[model samples]
Target chain A: MIAITIQQGRLFDPANQLDVITDLHINHGRIIAIGEAPADFTASKVIDAKDMLVIPGLIDLSTRLGEPGLEHFTTIARETKAAVAGGITSLCAMPDTDPVNDTFAVTELIQRRARQAETAYVLPVGALTKGLKGEALSEMVAMHREGCVAFSQANQPVVNTQTLFNAFDYAATHKLLVMMRPIDAYLGKDGVAHRGAISSALGLPDIPSAAETLALARLLLLAEETGVRLHLSQISTARAVEMIHDAQARGLPVTADVAIHNLHLTEFDVADFASFMHVQPPLRSQRDRDALRAGVKAGVISAICSDHTPLMHDDKLLPFPESVPGISGLESLLPLLLALVREHILTLEQAIKAVTHQPASLLGINRGSLQVGAPADIAIVDLETDWLFNRRQLMSAGDNTPFHKWPFTGKVHTTLFQGRVVHQPKLA
Target chain B: MFGYPGLSSPSLQLNEAGKLKHLLTLEGLKPHHIQDILDRADGFINTDTRQIHKQPLLKGKTIVNLFFEASTRTRTTFEIAEKSLGADVINLNVATSATKKGESLLDTIYNLEAMQADMFVVRHAKSGAAHFFAHHVAPHVHVLNAGDGRHAHPTQALLDAYTIRHFKGADFSQLRVAIVGDILHSRVARSQIQVLNLLETEEIRLVGPKTLLPHDASAMGAHCFTDIEAGLKDVDVVITLRMQNERMSSARLPSEQEYFETYGITEERLKLAMPDAIVMHPGPINRGVEIASTVADGPQSVILDQVTFGIAVRMSVMAGIMQT
Candidate 1:
C-alpha cells in the first residue's frame, strides 16, 4: 500500500478534543501518525491540505440506500458515492428496504453490495419485526450475527405494546441496540405535516407533537422495563426532546438523533405546499426546532443524522398530502451542519461532534475519530468556499430535495476512506 | 371590498403581470380583485330579471371539470358556469378515469393538456391538489379550485360573498359573520373565513365544538366560539357548513343528535341573530343535523340563493381569469 501525507491541515477531531495544524501520515488503510510523522515513515504521495479543515469523516445515524430492492429510486453504489462526497464515511442503512433487512440473507446481501460499492461503510440496521409489520419479532440475534449493527422498525411502529415489549425484552437478552422512530400509529395516522397553524392553514393532514411524545413515552417505559439499549431516531418535537432528556437524566440507557432537515426547516416551509418539504415526523414549529437545537447543544440529543430517504421525482410530484415524505439529504448534510455553525445554532466543534463521535459511539463503531491507528476516514473541507446546492450537482440517483438552490458556505475538498482517496472534486 | 391586506399569495394565484391566473385560494387576493369578481358576477346577472346571461367571454376556451372526489353540486355549478361563458366543458371523474388504471396525476394532466384543454376546474380530496395542477399545467392553462381537502373553495367563497352583498350591502365592515359547524374539515368554511376576513368584515366568528375547530382558528383572523348561540348573537351573516358523517367515526363528535341539539340552527336559535340577518349554507344541507328544516326553509334563509349566485360567481371567476 502507498503511504500518503496530508501536510499542514487544521486537524479538528472533536472526539479527542483536537484542533491543531498537523501532518497526518496514512499507510495500509490506517492513520499511522499525526503532527510530526515518525522517522521511519516514507510518503509516496503528498497532499497540500493547506488552509483547510481536516476532521473525522461523518458517521450518520440514519441513511436510506435503496438497494437490495427499489433500485429505481437509488442504489447503494450511487448513495454511498453521494455520502462520501458529503464527507460521510459511514452511514447506518435503514431497514425499510423492499424485502427489508429482517433476515440474515438480506443483511449479507447489503454487506456484499456495500463492499463492491467501495465508498462509505454501510452499517445495516436489522428490522425489529418480521416484514416490519409490527406483528411478530424477527430473528434479531441471527441478524445480529450477520453483522447487523442495530435493529429498528424504521417508520413502522409496533402498535401492540405487548409485541413491542417482547421485541425489546428479546433484544435486551441479546444486548442488541434497538433504534426506533417514535410515532403513535393512531395519533399520526395519515398525517403529512406538523399539527399546527401552518397545517391548519394549508389543510395538509397533521401529525401532532403528542404523536411523537406519546410513542416516546411508551418506548421509554418499555425500555425501562426490558433494560434495553434504546436509540431513538428522528426526534422532531420539543416534547420528545424533553422526554428524552428526562429519560437520560434518569439513566434509562437512551440516546437520540434528529434528522438534519428537522433542525433547519419547519412546518412553515410547507406553507406553500412544496411537496419536497414534506417529511415524516414532519418539520415541526419554530419553537420545537429551537428546542431540538438546544437538545443537541446540551448533549441530550447526541447526534444529527441525514435520515436520507431518496425518492423518484414522481414520488414528490403529488399533492402535499399524497407525496411521499423525506428529503434527499446525503449531499446536503455537511453544508447544512456548517450552516448551523454559521447561524450560531451550534459551534463548529459541536456540529462536527454530533455527526462524528456521537453517532459513532451510538452505533458502537470504532470509526469517527482521528487517533493514530484509527482507520483513516477523513474529510478535508474548504470551510470558506461558497456555493449553491443545485440538483444538477447531486450524486444520488434521487433529486427530491428541498435544499436545491440553497447557498452554502462550505464544500468538501477531498474525502479519504480507509486511507485511500475515495472522493476529490476536480479542480475548475 | 377594497384593499384588504395580506390574505393570500398573489404570486401562486396570479400571473407575472399580477392578473388572476388561478383561483386556488382567496387568502391572498386583493379586495378590489374580489370586488372585480363580485362586480363581474353582477354583470352576468340581468338586473330586471335577476337571471344569469350567457356570454362569449371564453367562447374558444376548453374547460375541464377534473373531479377527483365525488361532487354533484360543485361540479354542476362549475359546468353551468363554463357553459354560461360559452366555453366547451369536459367532465373527468377521476375514480372512473385513467387514474384508476394506474396512470399518474401528471399523466392524466398531460393527456388532458394534449387534448388542448385550456383550463381545469379541479375538485380533489387532497389539499393543494389544485396548486399541484397549477404548478404543473402549461403556462397558458389556468386552474380553478372548486374545493380541495379542508383547504379552499374560492368560487364558493365568492358566491357566498355575493350572496351577502346582494342582501346586506357592499360595506362588509358593518357585518359580523358567523361560520358554524365543522370548520376544521370544511374547505367551504376555510375559504369563507379568508374571503370574509379579506373583505374586512366587522368580525369573523368560527363556532364549533373544540374538536371540530382548528386549534389555530384565531391565527386565521377569526374568533372561535363553542356555543353556537353565542357565536350567532347579533351576527349579520350566518354560514352553516354540512357536518360530515365521517366526523362521528373519527371520534370528533358523539352523535348527530347531540350535534343538532348543541350547535344545530333552529327557529329559536335564529332569534339570536339580527332580525333581518341572512342565513347561508353551501348545500347539500343535513337538515336535522346542522340545521332545522324550518330555518333552512325560512324566509331569511338564502341557502338556495347561494346556489343561484354560485353559477354567476363561477362565471365571473372563469371570465376574469381567461380574459386577463
Candidate 2:
C-alpha cells in the first residue's frame, strides 16, 4: 500500500502526552513517522488538516450493535458507520443480545460481522452467566480465547450473590476483565426513570439511586475478595461515583466509566414521558450529573462511553413505563463531549483523553496512541463547526436518539481507520 | 401550571379548539371549564325525581366500557349515566376479550372503533393507559378515565367537587378540605387534589401516615400532614378514602387496626372540623378501616350523596365530550 501524509494539524495523543502541530506519515496501515517524513517515504495521498484538531480515535467502552437479533433496529454495518462518523474507532459490544453472547460461536459471529463492515473494531463482551439467565457461569475461558474482550452480565445482575461470586471466582482464575453494570434488579423493580419528584408527579415508577449504589457496594466487595480486574459500566448516580472513588482509593483493581448521556441529561428531560429518554440506571438528578462530571475531572471516573443501545422505531412510541430503555448514542457522542468542553466542564485535552487513552488503557488495547508503528487510527475534528443533529441525516436505522433536531457546535470532519478514510463529510 | 407534572395529557385530552375531547385528568382543566361541567350536572341531578328519567341528548350513541382493571362502582355509575341519557352501553370483559389471545391494546381499541363505538370509558391499571387510548383512538371517539394506577379518576373528582359545591357553596376559596387515608396508592387522591386546586380551595390538607402519603403531595398543592387531627382542624370538608386490602402487601400500611387508629375518621375526629362539616368517601368503603361506621352512616355523612352525584357528574362529562 502507498503512503499517506496528514499535514499541519494540531495532533493530540494523550497516551504519549503529546499535543502539537505536526504532520504524520502512514504506510501499510501503520503510522510510519511524525513531523518530517523519512527521505525514502513517498506520499500517494495527502489530507489538508491545517485548521483541524487531530486526535487518537475514540474508544467506546459499551455499545449495542444489534446484529445477531435486532438488525432491524441496527446492524453492525449501519451502526459502525455512524460510530465512525462520531470519530469512534473502537467499541466494546454489549452481551445483552438475542440468545445472548455467552458462547464462543456467538462472539465469533460478532467479530465476523465487524470485520465485514470494516468501520470500527468490535470487542465482544461475553455473558458472565450462561444465556445471561444468571443461573450458571458461561464458558468464559473459551469465549476469551475466541477474542471476547470482557465478560459481563450487563444490566442483568446475577440471580443470586453466590452465582455472582462463582462467576467472579471463575473470571479471576481466568485473569479476565469483568464489566459490571451495578443495579439491584429487585430495587429497580420495573421502574423506568429516577425515583424523585419528577417520577412522583408523572405517576411513573422510579428506580432510585440505591438500586445502583447497593449493587455496586456488593460487587466491589466481591471484586476485592476475588481479586478480579473489575470495570464498572455506566455508573450514573453520585453515590455510586463516590463509592467507586473510595474503592479505587483503597487500591481495589477497579475502573469505572460514565455514559455520556448521564453527564448531559437528567430525569427532568423525561418529564414529557418521552420514551427516548428512558435509559437504564435512568437519567439521574442534576446533582448526580454534576458529581459525575466531577468524577471525570478527578480521574475517579476513568472513561466515558456512548452506552449506545438502539431500539426499534415503535418500541419507544408507547407510554413511558412500557417503552424500552436506552438511546441511539453513537452519532451524538462527540458532539455532547464538545458541548461539555463548551460548558467548561472539561478541557479539550481531557475530553479527548477520556474517550481515547483512558478507555483504551482500561480495555488493555494498543490502538489509542499515535506513536511510531501504531495503527493509523485517527479522527480529524472541527471544533468550531456548527451543525444540527437531525436523525434523518444520521446513518443508524434506529434513529431513536432523544437529541434529534438539537444544534451542536462540534462536528467530525473525517475519520481514518488504519490509514484509510472510513468516513468524511461530502462538501456542500 | 407551575407545579404541573412533566407529562402533559392536554394534547391528548383536549382537541385543537381546546375543548374537552377526553376526560383524562383534571390537571389542566380551567376554572371555567370545571364550572361548566358542574352547571351542566345541576340540570341532571333532579332527573330521577321527574316523570321521565331519560334524555335524548346521547340517544343513539354507543358507549363502550373498556375496563382493563375491574371496578364495580365506576362501571355501574358510568353504565347508569349512559342509560339514563338514552345511550346504549356495552360492558366488555377485557380479560376474556381478544387481549387474552395476545392481541395488543390498540387492536382491541381498533375493533371497538370498527364496531362504531362513539366513546370509550377506560379504567386501566396503568397511569397513562387512558391518555394512550385517547391519543391513538379515532379522532371522533372520546375517552373517559374511570381510574388509572395512581394517576387520575376524573369522574370521582368531579363528583367530589359537586358534593363540596352543593353544601359549602360554589365559592370554594373560603373552604378548607382535608383528604385523609392512603394518598400514595389512591388514584382518587391524585385526582381529587387536582380538582380541589382548580376550584381554588383554601388550605387543601392531605392526612395520612408517612408511608401511605405520596412524596409529591405538597407539590400537587396540598399541605401534607401525618396527623389526622391536625389535618382535620377547622376544615369545611373531611374526605375519607377507601383503604384497599392489598395495600398491606404493597407495604404502604402496617396493619388494618393500626391504620384505623391513626388515620381513620371517627365521629369524634369529625368534631375537629366545622360544626356542619360533611364527610365524603369514594365508596365500596371498608366501614371500620378508613372511616368508622357511625361517621360513614351519620347525618354528616355525604358518602351516599357522592354516589348519587357520581351519576349526574359522569352524565355531564359524557354529554359535554360527546356533543356534536
Computed on C-alphas against the true complex, the DockQ of each candidate is 0.49, 0.35
User: Against the native chain B, what TM-score does each candidate's chain B reach?
Assistant: 0.95, 0.95
**TM-score versus the correct structure, for each prediction:** 0.97, 0.91
* Residue range B221-265, candidate 2, lDDT tens digits: 887998888899999999998888888987777799989998888
Top TM-score model:
1
DockQ, candidate no. 2? 0.35
The weakest ten consecutive residues by lDDT in model 2 chain B span: B96-105
> What is candidate 1's lDDT per residue for B1-324, written digit by digit as tens?
212233244687887787898999987777888999999898888645669899888898999999999999889988988998999999988883545322378889998999999999998888988888888988888999988898888899999999999999999999999999999888888888888887889999999999998868766788899988899999998899999999999999999999999999999999999999999999999989999999999999999888888899899999999986
Alpha carbon lDDT of residue B243, candidate 2? Answer: 89
Q: Write the per-residue lDDT of candidate 2 for residues A176-216, one digit (tens) a residue.
A: 99999998968857687787766666677778889899999
Q: What is the lDDT, from 0 to 100, of the residue A64 in candidate 2?
A: 93
Task: Calculate the i-RMS of every candidate, to one decimal place.
Answer: 3.8, 3.4
What is the lDDT, from 0 to 100, of the residue A186 in candidate 2?
Answer: 88
> Largest DockQ belongs to which candidate?
1
| Docking quality level of the chain pair in candidate 2 | acceptable
Name the best candidate (by lDDT).
1
